[model samples]
Target chain A: MELTLHVWRQKNGQDSGKMVTYKARDVAPESSFLEMLDQVNEDLIKQNDEPIAFDHDCREGICGSCSMMINGKAHGGRKGTTTCQLHMRSFKDGEQIYIEPWRAKAFPVVKDLVVDRGAFDRIISSGGFVSVNTGGVPDANAILISKQSADTAMDAAECIGCGACVAACKNASSMLFVAAKVSQFANLPQGQPERMQRVSNMVEQMDKEGFGNCTNYFECEAACPKQISVGFIANMNRDYLKASLLHQEPVGKA
Target chain B: MSWIVRLQKSSLGSKYIMAITGAGLFVFLIGHIAGNLLLYFGQEAMNAYALSLHHLPYGLLWVARGGLLVFALAHVFIAYRLSFHNRAARPQRYQYEATLQASFASRTMPYTGTLVLLFILFHLAQFTFHLVAYNGPYTDSLGRDDVYTMVVNAFQNPVYSVLYIISMLVIGFHLSHGLSSMWQSLGLNHQKYNLLFRKLSPLAGWVLCLAAASIPLAVLVGVIK
Candidate 1:
């Protein structure tokens, strides 16, 4: 199949980017979206032209590294499918595909179809962890967590940190991402000790990173590749409210 | 740090402020609509309801009005703050923007809210302050303030009724998103109640706005003279 591609091109972060058109000829329908791009790049290299640059570590989609807005949609608007997993057959013959990077102040464009998502890492480092002694591995059954709670935790843990939620949100709010990170622990026994502090610290970091607030539109859930639920956001909101208001620990301890 | 200061600084805190104030305003809307429905019961009943509100002791009516003003101001103020913050978050927009899930009402909250606020100001001028051309220090047969006649005279004008009906539609549009948003912002979501909670916004929005609009429609049709 032949396809026309409008890809974003940028020299560096300092250089303002623009869309550049390219042609993908002799592309196989069975080939993945990334493979089609690779073929296009190979042709560009043979012609002594700059190739489009994007991020993709694991083509399997678990690494959440392959981030791009295809046709103005995160991960090509496929249900639970990443760009690397999307096939060329998803489009018709001779279709024009518009590919761009995620748009967010927190996620700046690094190059063609690549945006920096280091803000997510900062949010995680702030509180997205459980403090535990490294003396020994505890028995999994020792905690005696309910099956329902375990299921909730596991569901929330499916988040891949792809920043699609940020990209799709009109406000560019990372609430859904932060909510997933917060809820994965909030639903478990081991997450009990630092529940209050975790939400407070992580939320503070998220605010400092200049992400917008969630207005309950649920756009993040729709864009999420892992199909993360907005219920986590409500859990985070509940926990944050309690943490900030009712559970204020003493000055030095907190 | 004080929780008050903390609430002022955080994003979730901002949502809480909006939810709490929005919930208050929503309750006031319910009461306002309920009171206005008295117009359907004839002029005497409507005038009596107005008189009862005026007869409250210790200037309680004034206190209620003041509280509503505070809620409206806070709701609008935080809305602006959040809008600016949201706009700044996406300094550069997508060239080919597409919305997959957000409703028309959810996306247009600020515009609808601004329209509602303007309507409220105009409504106050026309009715509450009696500053419009139909100003009435009117007295009924019982020597009471004839609020019923004032309302009837106002809605009888085709221009006034049309403006009122349009304003009601806008208010309904605003509440369709806002009522549901309040529950989520307050951390009140559950799987069992989620469906009901989601339906509550649009259902309540239409019901309340239509109920309020009914009075003007009835007056225009000469049913409440």
Candidate 2:
């Protein structure tokens, strides 16, 4: 199948980007979306032109590295599927595909189809962890956890930090991402010690990062490649409220 | 920064304000609708209810009104602030954005909320302040402010009835998203009950809208005369 692509191109973060058109000729229908882009890049290299730059690692979809707005949708409009997993057959012959980087103030364009998602890492660094000291590994069964709680925690833990939630949200909110991190810990027994502090610090970091607030639009759930639920956000909100109301110590101080 | 300042400055904190204030207002709406439904019980019953409210001890009526005013102001103020934050968060928008999960009510929250606010002001002016004249006399047999007569006379006018019904519908739309979203914002959500809230939120909105609209329609059609 042949396809016309309008891909956003930029020299660097400082460069003003614009949509540059390219044609993917004689592409196989079975080729993944990233593979199709690779084919296009190979052709560009032969002609001595700069290839389109995009982020992709572990094309199997777990890394959450491949981020792009294909046809104005995060991850090519496929629910629970990343760009690297999207196949060319999703489009028809001669179809025009518009590709752009994630359009959030937090995620700036790095180059063609690539945006710097370092903000996500910074948000995570703020408090997305358990501060438990490294001692002898405790018996897994020593701290008995209910199956339901464990499953809920695992569900929140599935978030890949892709920033697609921010890309898809009208407000560019990272509430879902932060919520997932907060919920993963909040739901577990081991995560209880600093639960309040964790929520407050992470939320403060998310705010400082210039992400928008969640208005319960549920777009993040729809656009999430990992199919993360917005319920985690509610959990995060609950934790933050408790922490804000009851805990007097500043986030980092505690 | 102080916690209060952080709460005020953070986007999520403002949403918490909206949720809390919206919940307070929701409670007021239920009470208001119940009182208005007294119109179905005839003029004496409605007037007695109004008199009872006015006669509450310790200046309770003023206190309740004052509380509602604060809730209204907080809800609207936080919402306005969040909207500005939302716009600034996304300076560049998608060329062809498509929504997959957000409802029509969810997308048009600001417009519906503003409409509801205007409707509330108009309602208060017409009924509470008597700034707008009713088509007929408002006095009851006991020389009290005949709440039922005022409502019936106002609805008897085609223009007022239609406007009332339309405004109620807009309020319904606002409540459809607002009620359940308040739950999520306040972290009252649970996996077991989240679906229930989502389904019931809109149902509650429809119930309020229809119940409120029914009074005007009934009055307009001479069912309550």
Candidate 3:
């Protein structure tokens, strides 16, 4: 199916971008959205023009590198799906799709449809890790976490750090992302030692980095490819508030 | 401004004021609904109900009015403070944008809230002012004074009922997210009530919507006719 695309293009980080329309003919319905994009890049290269640059790696959808705002909805109107996982079949003939990068102060656009999710890395670095050695991976039964507990932890860990939560949030908050990372570590005994410092540092870092407070909109949950629940954000709030109240300033931003 | 968010994070006073004031507003909704239902009680019953409110002891009467005034002002003040902090935390708005993606109620909050504010001002002017609209204390046929009759009379016009119904709907959508959301924001939700809050939140919104809007609808259909 042939489709008209309104894609944002900017020369660099300082360049102001606008929607420049392009046309692609004879696109296959089965092609994944990224592959369809590849077809367009191939055409652009043949014309000696710069191929549109977007984030992608291990296109199987695990890396969380593929981020784009397709049409008005994040990840192109699919529930629990990533942009790489989205297929052309979701589009119709003669449809004009608006493609842009994730919009947030923290996740600024690096180029067209590509944003720097490094702020997430910084948040994780703040307090997201378990510093305790735990004696080089003790016996599996040592801590003995229940199946239910492990499953819940896994659910929180399912977050891909894609910044969809930030993009989907009306306040552009990254609480969901920060909370998931904190809970994943805090839920397990292995992360117990640094839990206090971890939460305080992470939360303080999240604010310092310019992310908005979680207003309980729960939009991030709906937009998440992994369907990560916003419940983790509540957990983060509980932990952060406790840390703040306890006057536990983290060990220098961890 | 930053101090407000910090103070809100610091202790129970700030958030409790917000929650208590919010819950007080919730109570007012129930009372408002109860009084509005009096419209279906016919002119006499409605008039008697309104009159009884004024006949209460002076201390009690003043206390109730003062409480409502405090609750309304506090709710708006906290809302404005929260909105201001939220703005300070984010970048400027772009014409075309996408978000972590939220429910419809979540997205339209500030707009719905603005409309509700305008409605509230007009509502007070129309219902509270004597010379401009509502005259002196109403009295029932049996010589008992009543104010509810004025309510029924006011709702007699189809235009008024329709406008009231629309505002109720907007209030419904607002409460859908606003009620449980206030709790979640303050960190009151936990494992047991987490799902319960999310599920019941929408139900409560619908109940408020239907209950609040039902009065206007019933009056408009002339069920009292």
Candidate 4:
């Protein structure tokens, strides 16, 4: 199969980018989208030109490092699939695919098709952890978590921290990502110690990171590679509301 | 930060304000529509209802009016601020954009909301304040402010009726997305009931729009005099 690609090319963080077109001839249908891009970059390298820069690691869709918008839909518009897992077969023989980096105030473009997602890390660092000092790993059966609670927590834990939700959101909100992280911990017995503090701190950091608010558009859910539900967002909202409304300072140094 | 400041400054907190104020306004709409439906009964019934509202015992009318005014202001102010924040969140525009899950009503909320705000102002000017002139007297048989006659006369004008109908439809568009969203924002959503809310949002929107539009349409067609 042959395809036409309109890829954004920027030299650096300070450079303004524009779409540049290229033709990929004799591409195999079984090749993943990143493999196809690799073929294109290989050709560019032969001509002594700078290859297009895009982020990818596992190529198995779990790393969440591969991020790009294909034809304006996040993760190539597939359901529950990441960009690395997207196959060339999803496209027609003579299709024109436009690829660009995730666009958000918090996730700025570092180069062509590569964005700096450090904001996500900062948000997680703010509160997304359990700080309890368990000397050794406790017995798994000691917790006695209910089946329903376990399943729900796992569902929320499936979030890969990819910024596709932010990219696809019309408001560029990171509510889904933040919600998944909060809900994963909020549902477990071990997470109860810092539950209120976790929600309050994460939400404050999310706001400080300059992400927009969720207005229930549901675009983030559709664009999510994990297909994470927006219901977690409501849970996060509930937790945040409770924490803010009924908060008492912990008995410690002020 | 203080909780009050956080509620005003944080995105999630402001959404709570929007949800609470929107719910308050929605309640007012339901009451307003039920009262206005009295117009179909007869002039006496509608006029009596208006008189009762005017003669509420302990200044309750002013209290209700004041509460509604506050709710309307908060809803509009928070919505305006959120929209501007949303626009700034994505400084760059997509070259080719496509929406996969959002409905037409969901996508056009800000536009419809602004139109409905203007309609509200116009509606109050024509009816409540008597700022807009109509070719009729403003008194009924009991020498009260004749709301029934004023409403009918205003609707009799073809231009006014058409504008009112259009504005009602726009209100429907806004409510289609706003009602269910208020539920989600308030944390009332459930996995089992989420689909129900999505379906019901548009149904409620259209029902309210049709009910509001019926009065003007009835007047225009000479069905109500």
Candidates' DockQ values? 0.80, 0.68, 0.30, 0.80
Clashing pairs in 1: none
lDDT of 2 by residue, A1-254 (tens): 99999988889988887888999999999999999999999999999999999999999999999999988789987988999999998999999999988988888887877888888888778888888778898887999899999999999999998889999998999999999999998899989988888888888988877888788989889999999998888888878878888886556743
Docking band of candidate 3:
acceptable
Tens-place lDDT digits, model 1, residues B1-225: 567887766899999999999989989999888998998898888989999999999999999999999999999999999999999999988887787788999999889989999999999988888787575778999999998888888888889998999999999999999889888998889989987679966798789999888888888888877
**Model 1, runs deviating above 4 Å:** A250-254, B133-135
Models, CA RMSD each = 1.8, 2.7, 4.6, 1.7
lDDT of each: 0.91, 0.88, 0.76, 0.90
Ranking by lDDT: 1, 4, 2, 3
Candidate 3 wrongly placed segments (more than 4 Å):
A25-30, A92-95, A133-140, A213-217, A241-254, B1-20, B36-67, B81-103, B129-132, B137-145, B186-196, B214-225
Question: Lowest summed-lDDT stretch of 10 residues in model 4 chain B?
Answer: B128-137
Real interface contacts reproduced by model 2, as a fraction? 0.74
Which 10 consecutive positions of candidate 3 chain B have the poorest summed lDDT?
B7-16
TM-score of each: 0.96, 0.93, 0.82, 0.97
**Candidate 2 — number of clashing residue pairs?**
0
State how far residue B128 of model 3 sits from its true place (Å).
3.1
**What is the alpha-carbon lDDT for the whole of candidate 1?**
0.91
lDDT per residue, candidate 1, A1-254, as tens digits?
Answer: 99999988988899988988999999999999999999999999999998889999989989899998888889988889989999999999999999889989999888888889999999999999999898888886787988999999999999999999999998999999999999999999889999999999999999999999898998888889999999899999999999887875577943
- Model 4, range B1-225, lDDT digits (tens) per residue? 566897678988999999899879988998998899888987889999999998999999999999999999999999999999999999998887987798888889889989999989888877776677556567887888677888888888889999989998888888888888887787777968877677786687689888989989999999889
Q: In model 1, how large is the Cα lDDT of residue B210?
A: 91
Candidate 4: TM-score of chain A is 0.97
